[model samples]
Target: MSVDGDPVSETPTIKEGTWEAIALASAVMLIVWMFIAAGWIILAGEIELAQKRTAVAAAFVTAGAAVVTFCTVIWRGKINERQTNTARDQLRATEEANWAKLLQDGAALVFDSQTGKQSAGLASLEAVVQTQHRLFAKQAMNLIADYLEQVHPTDHRSPLAIAAIDALGSGHSLGFQAARSLKFEGPNKDNKRFAPRSIWVPILGVRLVRYYGGRMDTQYPHFNEACRHSTFEKVYFSKASIKDMSDFESCFFRNCKIEEIGYMIQENTFQSCDFSGAVNFGIESIDDMPDLRPRNNFYWSDRPPIGVTEIDWASRIISVPSQFSNVFAGERLMTKEGRDFIADEVLNLQRHSN
Candidate 1:
């Protein structure tokens, strides 16, 4: 039979078949000898003549069987050992391939942002979320979005749901960026905003990631083509996890201004998503200023049984959008009150009996 791709290894089946055929051949030869001795094939004079004729045929058959048995057994054993040793190598190659694809896509996003090929990279990242591979599907897609947010800072990006669905891939910290970018827009003429595209290039590009089981870590053009049509639109973050983020300090939202976002994260963990100078903030008046604060010194950690796995305030100074107004509203908020507020934000998401 044939298969779509090259068989990863082939010795096990050959080895088993060789052993079976060897045993069958030995049994056949023994049966033939016993029949000859018992005169089953010949009578008197004819027996000697028949034996003479059959002896050469039997010799050839036995030799052929021995050659097949010996060759398959020996060759199969060697090939099987080689295959076993190469298994780890195969896994490593797979991982390297995944990483390469990821870097390629990331680079493309950066280039696209600089060249104005797309307003956002969320659609490109979302394209890979449908992959069947579970290992890094979420991580890779989310990271692409993260890289995009870092590279491009504007309001004309895709909605956050693109990342939300991707985050559902594995719930890693990386996926939180896209989740945090989540926002809702009513179906309108704004296909450039959050809906599907009129041109199928982006969709087709994303569809390729799905074909590779979501492990298209090296396909740059795949992402660049997908988000090529995106114009700077609203980016929202919703239902995020701190444990899903990596290099939290290095990450930024750039110049985008997020709106109408409902995000809940675990407390006392490092901040999974950062919206510092990276986001546009678009604060035109003091009213918006009331809700803005400088965020610093944050990290991510999984919650202990007694704690929660999340992005939390590493220091009292790292205030978030939700807590900005409460911490710095005109006059300085009391130290005790601020600490309590920060503590409350960390502990208030929900009470789980761990």
Candidate 2:
């Protein structure tokens, strides 16, 4: 007997009891038919015996077919389930591989010091601006800048640096905006602070140093008024250029009591700042002076008689313990020499308004 809706097995396994019963039923049916025929030969009437034998044979075949069908259904269902599980496993594996590749690419972009790859990495990071993976973006930008600075000296001044500077200024998560100002100086020599030679982010260029009057020899509270408005103390440079010291104009001394001005040629600006406690500045120009006048209103100097005049011009001079002179030799708000320079500048500023 064959299973319904399934191909017949080539070497079908017959159950022992069922096979024996089938053989017995076949023999019984054959004997019944033969007996009926013999009776027919003898009496010519045996239709009931033949009908019963045929019905029993049909019932046995149907029972065998049902058993075969049930077994085939169970086997086919298991095979389909196994195939489904295999397909699901393959899909999961592919997803994992893709994710791993992406992470690898990200790390390479961050750590590798190649220009093209660095740019590509940054571009990729920009594409995912809304993503939570901001740490990677910041690290990549830092590394890219470092790499460019290492190779091309002018690259530090390139627009790429400006882009990064803008990004950092944006107060975004992908930019290094929150890190505190740190000055990593070289190893200490002669009681100076020791800092390993490494990357360091300064507080506010040189202006902060000026406002604080460098490192204090004595802990004096001689503050600068400029310190009061240093809202962007943590902001780097504030659009400062390599030519002009933007921080210089922005710096004011708060609660300051310094007596002398200090200057440092940092970046592009000459920082004219006051020093508190003991330190005072004297003009030590690289060029031999023709005439020297104090830019600030007051200066201190041991060499006196040339007290804080409206202006003083000398080949070389120091502002230390300088005498105070109330004798105004120039305009109330202008020095005798700076009048022309300031006049034209102030006029130009108000010219457009009127």
Candidate 3:
């Protein structure tokens, strides 16, 4: 203890204070506090009733401290207490390490074995996801995606798989920030986002995928690097929850029933997709409505939704080539400022004669 009441040092780190030093400090503090109380009580003695009451209170406190000091010495003095704490910490570390191993070896438990331990593995994976640490939780999420994709192509998944899929898709288990790191594919099979580290896994990252009819009864499924090149047709999104940050690029979607979706489909393109089945479309625009992702084009096959239908279709906020103006004039969601951008701007597709 120094003259100043700053108990903690300025540059304090976890590795501060040896157990011996800490114990000594505690004992010194205890003694000093007790002495001050005793001195105060004596100095105020034989005075006013308030002073007498204060002295009695001080006496009680000193007695309590004496009891505590005795107990400390008998039941594992400071050294023993410190040792017990160290042991407890070590135990916790061991448990964490074990869980992390289960996280890393998740595929074996999930994909491998017939002892009904597959469910156990999924449970372990969920455990890792619960922690939501970028290291283990991200990998756990990636594994969860792998398991879902393995069963996604087909209509049915084991109850265990469905449960796991929902836990992940809903993003209820992994929290907000971690859920955004999720990916269906990457730039190449060999990479992940710069924030977290991951290895190449099938369905982890791919450029293009053309999905045919399949019942995608899942939650919050997203494709990363393959958005533009992926195509989904006759896919039924049953109970599927599309989050706010989702993106769908030039990929064609036909006869797809998007049962439930809440997202920002920005300067993205939708040429011949039916919007009748799409539900829960979010009202907030990702950008300032007409700024970023400027190359947006919407050509819905059905009547557009409310927020989208209100787009200033006739407003030409930005100038575009007169010929291109004729190309997008009929689009229900196109705004004038949005008109300045064209499909070929991002997709690099050659423009066809209007």
Candidate 4:
């Protein structure tokens, strides 16, 4: 009976057993004939002739044996090569499984309730990043970014928070398909290190859509702290107030609302950004700013920000109280009304060279 899933032979049953029987009978007949020939060569009257014929037979048999030996060596070599390749493939598969297991175990640690376990989990996730697995890297980064998203708004500098920040920065080493934005939702006294999310998130360049448009670096409006070497690109500072913030170098303030900033804006690059969106973009005088000079212009010697559109001046309140101190693009300010409106607010920001 044929087994399940096994193929049945289609050849006639009479032909199958007959072929093997015929081959066995043929071999038996050949052996009998060989024995008879050996008797004739050894015991017949022409002994000299028999000796010569035996030598000839031996020569032919030796040649045949050489050919068979060569073929056998070639066949064995091919078998070895195929086996080696199969082994290598198996080893690679096993290694990849180990890496996947390591990643899974480490990611689980990050969600544990204990702070120490969470820290260990973060470390494991970072280790996964080192493995250079694309999916793992993305997941690791998302975990840290999510953890940071949980931070409260009191300017938390905790060891764990610090680790999370560093993890995100390191996780995006490859820099493709990144979870770019982090939101600092609000402050909490209970978990002091958890968040001062609103204030510091903006300068970090992650757009806070609730506060700004994209990543709100720091969303809290009413803190008088000094900020340095931060970048704000395509940013909208709608309901925020900054004081004593200095050295905002090479930054792009796009569609920003400069509502009532302190006079200490110094050594900062605010080029290539649009301030046209503000209903009342107001600033205190830059007379206290040490870098203010009649010789230099804010919009001069600078390329426009990465995504700046053609700026319109007439719509907002434009007034240049200091003509020589035009910080915006010099001749590009086309409209009289736009210029008047922009100048009005910017003049308040203009510095006295005295």
TM-score of each predicted structure versus truth: 0.27, 0.27, 0.38, 0.40
lDDT of 1 by residue, 1-354 (tens): 222123475555645455656666765765676566456435546767778756765776577667667756666676677788699669867855765575456446634534443324444444444442344454545465454334422222344423423333333323222322422222322322223221111222121211100111112233333333222122221222222221111122222222111121111122222332222212233232222222222111221111222222233223433333333555322344444554565554324312
| Candidate with better lDDT, 1 vs 3 | 3
**Which stretches of model 1 miss by more than 4 angstroms?**
1-103, 115-124, 152-354
Backbone clash pairs in model 3 (N, Cα, C under 3 Å; residues 3+ apart or in different chains), count: 7
Could you tell which candidate, 1 or 2, scores higher by lDDT? Answer: 1
Assess candidate 1 and give its lDDT: 0.36
The list of candidate 4 runs beyond 4 A from truth reads 1-78, 135-138, 150-159, 175-183, 187-354
lDDT of 4 by residue, 224-314 (tens): 2213223332232333333323333222243333322232234333322332222222233223333322212222123211122333222
> Lowest summed-lDDT stretch of 10 residues in model 4?
299-308
Q: Which regions of candidate 2 are displaced past 4 Å?
A: 1-118, 128-130, 134-142, 148-155, 167-292, 295-338, 341-354
Query: Mind giving the per-residue lDDT tens digits that candidate 2 earns over 1-354?
Result: 321122455896554455445555555655665556455444434667656655665565566555555555555555576688689669756744544455457546744566566556545433333232344434434443433333422212344433433333332433332232222221221221212122222221111222211221112121123232232111112211122123333232222233333342221111222221223243244242221222321223433322222233222222333223223565112244444443443454457547
Over 4 Å off in model 3, which ranges?
A: 1-81, 113-115, 131-134, 170-172, 176-354
Q: What is the C-alpha RMSD of each candidate to the true structure, in Å?
A: 17.8, 21.9, 15.1, 14.5
Using TM-score as the measure, the top candidate is: 4
In model 2, the Cα lDDT at residue 198 comes to 22
The 10 consecutive residues of candidate 2 with the worst lDDT sum are 211-220
